[model samples]
Target chain A: MKLPKKVKINEVVLRDGLQLEAKILTLDEKKKIFDQLVKAAVQTIEFGSFVHPKLVPQMANSGELVELISENPNDVKLIALIPNLKGAKNAREKGVKNLNFVFSASDTHNEQNVQKSTKDSLSELKEILSYCKEQDICLSVSIATTFGCPFEGEVKKERIYWILEQLTSLDLETITLADTTGMANPQQVYDLITELTNKFPHQLFNLHFHNTRGMGLANMMAAMQAGVTSFDASLGGLGGCPFAPGATGNICTEDVVHMLHSMGIETDLSLDELLIASKTLQQLVGHETPSYVLKAGPYDRKYSIPTKK
Target chain B: MKLPKKVKINEVVLRDGLQLEAKILTLDEKKKIFDQLVKAAVQTIEFGSFVHPKLVPQMANSGELVELISENPNDVKLIALIPNLKGAKNAREKGVKNLNFVFSASDTHNEQNVQKSTKDSLSELKEILSYCKEQDICLSVSIATTFGCPFEGEVKKERIYWILEQLTSLDLETITLADTTGMANPQQVYDLITELTNKFPHQLFNLHFHNTRGMGLANMMAAMQAGVTSFDASLGGLGGCPFAPGATGNICTEDVVHMLHSMGIETDLSLDELLIASKTLQQLVGHETPSYVLKAGPYDRKYSIPTKK
Candidate 1:
């Protein structure tokens, strides 16, 4: 039950949340959500991904979105998801200061996601790292399918350890172990995170979890218990695994913040403002989002007493 | 990270899950669901409640449903929810062996639910206790809104401790602290349960949580860390708080069992069969359930890899 007094929430609604959305949000819509997030005091935001427009048409405006918001007065860290060296170059050209390089730990998933093997992805990470250093950009690496793969079932601890061994030497800002398809249980999250933190005490780690199987918040609790203080969450619980169609995406940003604040753990994010953003996103998506706090409201919310007949 | 080796799940879908539903299931439908639960090796089932038929039309057939399922050959513990001595008498007359008396810890909630104050409800519980003893029926008690109340924001820890003090002297089978509105956070659950368990070392306790704000499983984990080994869950995540419209009900039974099993904590319940029951319940309710496992399947399930073009 020991928890950190405060935690960092890296908002990923713009990237992971909107990637699987059908209706491509206009740049104005994306900026509206971004402004709401900033108003909620979200310090870190993954604005969007610098992937091919044909492959993921929803994120086609990542470059323009970054260029539009990079001049904000707030001390917010704006991040862009980069899948390869070309994506990295595109993000840098857009004046994006922070980049998250994602490659699945599972070779099959890595191949499917980026058309490259895990080994090839790692080899490419080196190039991305040197490029980031030369360009004075902050880079973080997210190893997707770190818990289990949709195609490969369980991703072994050894595989994660080896992947860490490769990236631990790099001058990366953080390493995120992602439950790409929401296949992680709490015990697995706790055990793996504990071992990883102990093995790489100097390496700052973040966790990205999906609520696909409804273990998202529980896994976050386990990760927190294992000393992880930073996480990635999507507003309105948007995004989905292509493999698990109809499953929920990342844990809802407002729900996560609500839970943390309720547990007396501070995230410095406003639940009310997050809810506003969540509502806006839901409207933009033109569908009901799987956000619990949005529907149920916060726990401390008081309802008028019913009159006895 | 110290979880119990095994946990007991008390299935409460029949009463708590159905009480709020718009559809009033017939006795035959209840029996079908009961059969499925029994097939899934569920040892404990809250068959139905003995509340006024006009109050909860969905549970109007509780008497007939209990009578039809009580003759089953399985070693299942069938329990019924009773609000007062009258309900208790009705359940006993229907040949129910176990009765659960529920009263809210919040005076406003208790008054609204049963037209009585907290003290009056406790007094009535004494009458029900004597009646159960006279009839040789096992009795348990559930204190609703043990964490917080919709009408009364936060129910103090002292209030819960006071309620426990009043009930500790009674010959109850087990005492359940219910988060009726799903307001209890993990730290609060851990702190309160730890203190209560330490104070009442001889008492057996169960926790009932709703996924109202989506912290149900995380709260369960925290309770387990505090040494609680039994919980109440609903099939297909079926119930909802009357106060919070559209909020999810109790944690899904299959999802809970799936998580426990994944963590290597044995529950002795067949997950596949539970899913079958969940599916049947969904069809009977004529709506998609809030069950994550039913939609996404289990984590161990491997998806067929798509062939490259």
Candidate 2:
């Protein structure tokens, strides 16, 4: 099980991370983070979600953020989340070329999170899918809570396969399985990703993991062995599931990249720039971030031994 | 690779966890934690170390701890750390049946940590080995910094294999490879454990990992897939390398058990009891412990959705 020579990491700090925070960053603050992430050589970025402002106030500035960034497709690609046709229309209006749509594999979580049943959410996705095609936007579907759900104890693999099957019918080429609550174990991750990749050989897959149970990196490693090469990580470990209580942040991007590079795996991202970006984010949030690499720098940086008494 | 149905976990909270703390636990406090661990069905417990009180005052009471524990072979086996021939003599006099002796794989770490050269440490280990054999005691040798060293940067696998060859000649059956600085990544863990296990088919190997870089559980899983079952965990993630500054605690016992049980692997240990024991340790240490399971209960516990407002 040799890992791929390079893995693509999509930074999601501005969207998934800030969505769960109590304080919202100003327009300039958001732009500073975006520029720093670009400086760090993150090729793909998910910066905003076009949800209703009333539902998630922290993300109220999504449209403005989308309008502010330069439309340079060669240097970097930007992705925004859209829940339904209305959000998709808003994203298109704001010229978001790349978009992510999420539907939970667990019915209870789907309804609670997006206010729609699984079947109805897929139906709603059809409208958004048509809108994406007409607007020439790249759409990537994410199956949230694909491993396990808080309300629904253990999510069956059949549910995920069925959802993926529906997305396959919709002609979506790329899909992501999100461990929204971080209930994934290594064996479960390995088995399920192996099955999914084998069953859908033509479709590209990405993994989004939460570090709630401290299995985030372990699960990512399992997915890597099972042939996954794209992962979504947050700068400074800054995201949590809004619906799941006690859920921690996403796997820290700097931590993941540091480990990967140390193992001779290539990411083409700079750990030093990522640390500087993480520090800037910490200042904006006015709190210490949860980055492991930021706290304990790269593995090569040795701490001087405390002087013997 | 399918993991073994049952895994053996050796709890090192009382010994490894407390030894790094600024405060020390009293004899009664230590006994209480030990009794709870017994009730929780931990088969092997490393209670304390037989080092000089002047060097590590926290473990000065190893002999007393050994004397206090009941001599029931069926209930729980007690293991203690022995640094030199003098510590081995004290452990033998106090009736410790199992002993662990550590030698750093890097010469610099060995010299800085124990104030001995690698050759000198191995020579000292030979005397301790003879004493343990004469006393009819089981001995496990730990190769510290098997993956990387703080001072030495990266440790070569050849060095670890050479050290293991020396211990193998001593007729020892089990050896634990310790990632003392949390410097191991998943690939290195998988490759090394697989090669070591293949080379020494009959020898038992255990992993002692630190969670400093957040790779502890990930490394544990890699070892598990490579056919290594036994692991060393500290309750509430209690221990770290005292000589390695900025290193964190060992992998948390409760968190590991939680993930294993969720994956349908049998550990035969109670998560609830471990949590209770973790809380007790937190109170005794006068600070919140670092166990993820203690923060978030088992994954099956449901979280109510936050109101949309």
Candidate 3:
């Protein structure tokens, strides 16, 4: 199957990559990385999540970060994740333009994660959606654990379709299906993406994959084959859910970009610039990052010939 | 596209796994692992390589290992790797019933690896083929770097076709195209496998992939989409050429089997038994393996709900 010429890459390294990290990056450090991403021509960046600080202290600076970089010097879309109406109010007060609201397709996961049932979370999302419309703020909703649930296991596709039905009623422009614990397979990815795109022809669909089972790239390729043109990736594969066991990180941004560009698909992000951004992250983390392209250079980097001893 | 009902997998960890390892497993250790594979219902296992001990000290006991396991107690195909006419003679004397010969599609890699030009190695292979025919032994040849070379950047499809033209003259039953340096992408794998399988309808084509750039499982899925069934995998993701820089281990056997089985595709090998074999290898190597299945278990493995503190 032929893929689209250009795919939109929404980088989530700061929000998703740092949420589960032990060493919470300082505000200055976060801003420096944001500047680098803007310089690298990254169109969209998920800066931070507006969750309770007691729950996720790493993202405690979400409001201030949005306040600092909300100017959008390069026309970059800075997205702040809001968990509920309270988080949405906090972001709007801080002048955050674009906001992402997240809920899980699994009722059990939604209850465990947000202390509310899936129905209650949808009600809360509707409140946030109405508030965003009144404030003239751009909004998108993401369904976590869309593929599988760590507690329930093998999440049914009907759950996802029902959620999509609810979001479509709100006339939302975009929706993202996230493999929160990385429990997705290629066949499921292709089948679901095809079904969703066919069912909602007007809404933009994005895919968020974690590399928990080493099927990240394979799943991405399958999605591309199903005509998906938007993806979420982490700069250094930095993020994981604190509650999920053995959830390593998100799909490395540079690695997938390298593969896509090699296949003659455009990601609109420079591998060289991404590597530099990844290297800067290594210094903050005081070790090497978990990126394949960062570890091994681009595909065309030739190997040197060995001299005879 | 629908995949085949079952795919044939050849386990190559015993030979390719230990060849580049710093740890040398004894004969009894090898036998114990072989017994576990047999218990796992593995139909084929590459026991060892009959190469010069001076070059690869780890494979010095190949002939002895073959002599010990050549009885076919479980009806498994015990294959050995032979580099030249001398190694083939060594394997034949040891009562090995099945053998695989190695060469490279890239001329520079062929020269660096076996100290012979491509034409010269083909000539040498002709000699080995004659000997195998006279001895009534089964044979398969692997053309390494069929995708890309560490020394030479990209290998042309024309080069592979030419090699096939030469091998078809001998009426070989099977030929394996190996991505030696893990430099292959999904598009290249899909296009090449589709073309070759269509051109050579009579011969069985096997694909060998390395997880160097984390594209192993992706490439395998693409090959399956192209209608190829046979594959070569390593246990616990062990082995890489000492001469090929930046080349990592082969695709993990348990991981691939887990993915295939989850998709309703049968591989005829038990995942639980493969994990036991992976554990045995870890004990010998004194570290955790690089396998995702060994770490995360299978997809059906359920997680419990979190308790309130």
Candidate 4:
């Protein structure tokens, strides 16, 4: 029955949403969605990716996205997802303030997902952290598939802690755990968040949840109870897990903001602008996006008669 | 990392699903879905209701559906929901062996939902239980809104226990905790299930989950870890909160079955048949169902190559 204090919503629709869709958005479409996201007042946004544009052509215009986002830096943090040192350098050159390097704790998962072993990924991470420090940029080491993987069920908790222990030593800006495949249940999420937070009291942590198993928002709730403040979500529940096989949808940014804000949690986001962003994103994708709050139009939608009507 | 030994999948789609939709299903469609569900090897199916069908016309075919299911009951148990003594008497007359009665643990919720206070509902339940015993029918007392309520926000653990304590004294055959509005997180689910299982060692209990807040399956997993064996799910995720606003979708039976079976948990139902039933239900509803498994297909589908050569 205890209520959580604060929640920060990090919109990832631009990164994860476009990653899965067959419909790749143009630079203008991406800009419109990003503009709407800023208007929505989401504190942090996964503005673009630093991975090979050849593999993910949708993000070919990453440099341009950073340029447009910089026009109004007003308090909103624009984050970029970088898989390695090369990606980190590219992001830094674009003047991206926050750099998120993605890694996998499970060896089998790491090899299949990013085509590198966990050790090799860690070595790359070590290379990236120093450059980020030199640039005075915030570094958040994102551990993907921290829960069970679709290919490899039941990811051991010890393996995750070992990676986290390394991240702690690096003394980066933040650490984030991602249920990349949506295989996480609430207990695993709670256990991981609580254990990590307890061990690293001074460290900053973030949660990235996916709605593939329909536990995305619930997993977020468990993490919030365990004292997490920041989160990564996609507008209109964009994004599907690349390694998750059958999974779909990231945690919907508008849905998270709606729930958190209504519960008296300070998210610093506007619901109307969130919905507008979702609508614009939906048009870019050429299909209805996965956000419930945006599509359903809030609690009073059914009962609310328009003033004009 | 030890998997569960077995899982019980009870399809609440017929009664729970149709009631949540804006339009009503014809009696003929209900009969067809019921027949498919029975063939799906669902050991138990919540087929219909014996309430004032006028309030929920989607269940108007309940009487007819119950009669049809009775003609070929076989070993599969057919359950019917009864709200009060009148409904209980009607269900008994119709030859339903498994009768379920839901009552709210919160006094305000009980009053708002059913136009009766908790005490009045309990008084009515005593009559229903007495009648169920005389007819040699198995009875289950379900406490709804056990985790959180829309009207009152968070529901206390002690309130849930008090309701269980009262029901235990009534000599009911079974009991269950319903996350009726999808307000339950894993810790809450685990804590309540563990406490109840310990206190009532001799009695059996089940967990009912909703996907409104998207934690349905995760909470179910936490409950399973806590030693709960039975669950209530709707095929194709066809359900929502009746009393509480902003709720959406019951826990999809196909997703739950897929997760459990892949983990090597036995459910005695055919996965393919379950999907077929879900698809059929979706077709009748004229929409893409809420179940991710139905849309995403099995894990193997992710690996399948698109054929065009």
Give the Cα lDDT of each candidate: 0.92, 0.85, 0.85, 0.77
Model 4 over residues B1-309: C-alpha lDDT tens digits? 223699888789988877877668887788788777777788888888877776787887787777776776546788888788888888888778888998888776676657798778988998888888888988887887787765666778777777777888777766878877666666677777778789877767878888775556767767787788899999988887654444568889888887777556889888898888888898898877778877666543333222334
- Top model number, lDDT: 1
Among these predictions, the greatest TM-score belongs to 1
> Tens digit of lDDT per residue, candidate 2, span A1-309?
478899999999999888888888988899998888888889998989998898788889988987887564336888999888888888888888988998888889989878899899999888888888888998889898898998878899988888888787676746889998888888999999889878877777889998888888888988898889999999988888654545568999998998899789999899899999999999998887667778766778765655668
The DockQ value obtained for model 2 is: 0.56
The residue pairs found clashing in candidate 4 are: A17-A239, B17-B238
lDDT of 3 by residue, A112-152 (tens): 88988888999998889889999988989899999998889
The lDDT, on a scale of 0 to 1, for candidate 1 is 0.92
Which residue pairs in candidate 1 collide?
B239-B249
Per-model DockQ: 0.85, 0.56, 0.54, 0.18
TM-score, cand. 4: 0.78
Interface RMSD of each: 0.8, 2.5, 2.3, 6.3
lDDT of 4 by residue, A62-151 (tens): 888888777675567788989888898998888998988888877777776577999999998888888888889888888887876655
Higher-ranked by DockQ: 1 or 3: 1
Q: TM-score for each prediction?
A: 0.99, 0.95, 0.96, 0.78
Q: What is the TM-score of chain A alone in each candidate?
A: 0.98, 0.96, 0.97, 0.93
Question: What tens-digit string does per-residue lDDT give for candidate 1 at B216-296?
Answer: 999999999899999999999999989878999999999999999999999999999999999999999999989999998
